[model samples]
Target: MVAISSPGIGSGLDINGLIGALMAAERLPLGVMNARKDELNTDLSAYGRLKGAISDFKSAMGSLGAIDKFSVNAASSSNDGVFTVGASSTAAPGSYSIDFSDNGTNQLAQAHRLTSLDFADTSSSIAATGTLRIDLGGNSFDVVIDASNDSLDGIKNAINSATDNTGVTATVITVDSGSRLLLSSDKTGAANSVTLSDVSGNVAATLGMTTVSAAQDAIFLLDGHQVTSASNTVTGAIEGVTIELNALGATGTTETLTVSRDIGAVQENVQAFVNAFNDLQGMIGYLSKGDLQGDNTLISIQSEMRNIFNTAPTGLGTSLQFLSEVGIKTTRTGELELDTSVLNEKLAEDFNGVAELFAHDDQGYAFRLEALADRQLAIDGIIDTREDGINARIDRIDAQIENFEYRLTLTEARYRAQFTALDGLLSSMQSTSNFLAQQLGSLPGSAAG
Candidate 1:
């Protein structure tokens, strides 16, 4: 509660007549108390943001446990030496050959051999009603051809729109002043084949090609085993990876390739952790730096807050200590620096140990540290306490003012009543004395006569 000095109306009142002096005495302490309360409120709010960010950072660490760091290299490629490449950490590493041939698996590659199709002549127009049929694996579809429009471009768009199952694509090429509709599978290997039927006007005649092409399966040399696939895409070939065919044919010779996890993503995770730690440190530093000469109450509370961070909570994991173990050293300027190469090497050697350091055993030191940081940073925890204290002080001052006002009112009323009675007694005494003196003087003269 606030304590104020006695006012002019009270028993212990300082009767300094100067208005400035009186105003200064009342306003200065109130301002200080209010300022201290505001500081607490600001600090508390900052704490809340920090706590949330820290919690999220910790949660992100927990999620990191599930990610697997991997390294892979090519075992082999097909005999046809010129090979396509696809090796993601999420993909299985094994030798695969994309072929346009038949096997037991669903074909990833679909081949369409164009026959007497309508886009044979350059200037010819086929109606939209005219249908172009292409077989995608066993499923076949008739595309509504747009011949009145440019047949060369329209054929590509039409085939693409007609089928969802057709992994292969279509195009029209003009050679020697003649247009031909060309359909090719988007995926590699034999399974991605398309066979075109039902055509009109010189398309095959222009190309000089015959016998519609059939779809073939993918052939892979899996761990030295010759495996054939009827599909261009394969899943679970290895865990956490999928393969999509980008090109066609088995080049005669096999090649070796290497695959690994994305290093950039791992680096980002490390940086996030570093940022969160720095934020926590900054918040603590701000609260600790208080004006010593000004009101010491705020300073005292801030000191206590600093102490909360400085002490180590028991039951926390030793692994979670950042300052000593991870090679994060403080400079003379009191800023942190990380030995990244060393840290990375340690992480590579024992990633589990790195994880253990950040994660506490259920309800361990790390968790406790997180909780402490949360409370210290939260607006309600710090600001609310200070504000409440200031308000209590102000209430006490108001009460004191009320008591002083009550006593002054009663004393003023009694003084007025006593002064009135004294005036009457004085008046009566003056009149009687005057009359007695005059009579005494007159009686002496009469006796002489």
Candidate 2:
């Protein structure tokens, strides 16, 4: 027998409506679980935002911790009319005298260029099949020519498009006489002069390139001694220093080059440090009023960070040991403020001491704060642990939802099966009643109608 899919058809009891009501009541728990999952997801998103803010704060602290690095040596020339100088962070603070004399000596490097003998036209085809090996200093590449690209323009395109072509540019220049292929090396000096030879065919001979400009190295006199460089930007002339020669100095012109600590940079760094800390505090304030309200992790971080204000670094051989001594102080509102006048005075008084106050190896506030941030962001840190716990709870809730949904499915099926059987029973009873009524009518009335 086929199961009665339309349960109310035989019994006329609206079995489908009744089962729907019971199933709705059974699904109440699912709604609660879904709500809980939504809440957890919202919490996770909040944490993600919080984590980003913390990472940003950590980076700011790290930069400030290494703030002394910016105070490293700055190379400068007494007169920058002829040349300029730059020094690395490790460059020592010192002074050197560089004398320049324009006694028929070149001070700027020249790159090598080649001009191809005039061609008939851009479409002129020549030797079609061979390879030309192009050499530039120690770097070299081979150009392959075939029947498809035998024309002058084709060869130019091939050379320009070669994967291994190192710092070589091919250009097609047309003149009143004819078209010419111009090849130039981007590198400077005689060592990087362009040279080529035909490996398989007469491609090199067909091009007929001649030196337009010969490569020349730069020569200058440092401290009464001659210094030579392949490039105008000279390095290793002074340890960790680079001097760029723009023009040859006049005869017998000597300028003083000084490498010294940039004391002025400290003021800017201190201002930036103030701004960064304020921004972090602002973010923390915003989060505290919202989803992270009463959160232990955030509270702990805030408390620990504030704890630095009460304590001062000790055992440092510096007159400036406290932040307040350097114009950094806290307001009644609990945000940081800088006194520029005091900071400038401190900078002029003792610049290195200020650097040590904020960036010393272990006792500095910047170093300590940065280190604290590292621990919070590290693997299995407090933030991660909290997030992980929340995720685990969400996972368990998901399992519960899945299991409950399965049970709900079974429960709905059981209700439908029971209603279907009740409908069949009621239908059978109605048929029996109809048959008995017909038999009684036939016996009593003897077919009166």
**Candidate closest to the true structure, highest lDDT:** 2
lDDT of 1 by residue, 224-290 (tens): 4555555545555545444454443343433443344444455455565456556545654553463
Candidate 2 lDDT over residue span 1-449, tens digit each: 98756777888889979999999999999999999999888878877877787787777676668645556677898778777999887688899887654768746788998988777888878755699888999789998898888887898899999998998988888899998888898988879999989899888888888999888898877877888889988999898898988777788778788998765666676777787777777777877888777788888988888887666888666877789998999888778899989988887788777777888888888888888888888889988898999999999999999999999989999999998888999998998998988888779566767
lDDT of each: 0.50, 0.83
- Residue 157 lDDT, candidate 2, scale 0-100: 93
Instruction: Give the Å shift of residue 55 in candidate 1.
Output: 8.3
Give the 10-residue window scoring lowest on summed lDDT in candidate 1: 65-74
